[model samples]
Target: MLHCPRTVARTIVYSGIFLATGVSTVLAADPTGDWKVADGVANIRVAQCSGNMWGVVAWEKTPGGKDKNNPDTAKQSRPTLGMPILIDMKKKPGVDAWEGEVYNAKDGQLYSSTIKPVGADQLEIQGCVLGFLCGGETWTRVGPPIPSSPSNSMAKGAPKAAPGAPPKTAAPAAPPKTTGAVNPAPAPKAAPGQKQAAGQPADIGDICLLPDIARFAH
Candidate 1:
């Protein structure tokens, strides 16, 4: 956690524009960890994967919510529990910034995103259009990465267990029937998550990442 004054997160909501306050900066080191959104309602876990960084909705206080604005019809009501909102981010050469894409669950649009680490804890994450229109928050680090249980770590194709942590066993499979098995059938193709054809939105986003920042203040 960042060592700073207990301040409330307030936004200058000026005709679809947002400016985040409360500033303190330091060397922007590795931004791969759990970060508390400005409003403190959700925790985003950022990690390095496959030579790129990815962020997911690690935990949310929003109860039983689904992606209501997803453009994909088939995935409209998908749960946000473990969704990847920030994908395929690469660190910029010689800068404390990472460039990538951010998925806005509110409008179902993917905006070009960049994250610049201020201090060791604060991160300025802005998602925007071609170059100018943008919105973002100064996220504070919420300690280290949320420790993944052995089972969950393994399930995610990794065994990033903590030091001295024990390995967990997978759930048992169902027993085979004492009869001839039927042949498997092919499944239908999946829908596209995003579009390639381009044209950006005039406003990137309206949702304040952590609208209720005070609720999660330490």
Candidate 2:
């Protein structure tokens, strides 16, 4: 759904990295990194939390501004600073696709976003809700973590905090279930899907998201 030129640019940039470095290496680029949005419009400070992911709008600035981190947007409901966005990603079993919420930076609202990993260096980010009227662009594997300042001791690989600071303990187990409520039995299985016989269409779900959506009928 993205405009032709942007789509083409993203594909070239992302695919080049994928081919050169292989997919697994790219996937290792943690969502928890200091990711700069598209052309450095804003910096999202990301970190993993309780097995989920969270992003804080750390730094943002207008195209050419005095304070790089302070945009001159309204400071009311849509404040020009200090906001955290939470993304919940779940895997769809049938398609093995990642579907999640993407925050709208302008209004501070979440939208349904689906991402499918392709190779190591690219993820097709679909920024839409309806199936057809969607725009998507591939995000290429960016460079490694930015170097830390020498003044920061931890940044220079200082020793970590001792592990003896009260290791996390597991919660006590629940008491055994006593009520004799019988669990339901498994249901009968459905017939298997047809193989690639008689000119069957390819499974688009397994195909890379960008290419697949590009070929999707309007």
Q: Report how far residue 205 has shifted in candidate 2, in Å.
A: 37
Root-mean-square deviation per candidate:
19.3, 25.3
How much does candidate 1 score in TM-score?
0.54
lDDT of each: 0.56, 0.41
Clashing pairs in 1: 26-119, 39-210, 39-213
lDDT of 1 by residue, 1-218 (tens): 34333222222244223222222222246676667788876657665553455676655654355888898888778766556777677889988788999888879989999988776778788999887688888888764532222221122333345988886674498433211111122211223663322232111111112222111110
Highest TM-score scorer: 1
Candidate 1 CA-lDDT value: 0.56
Q: Tens digit of lDDT per residue, candidate 2, span 173-211? A: 842321111122222122375222332211111111122
Question: What are the models' TM-scores?
Answer: 0.54, 0.39
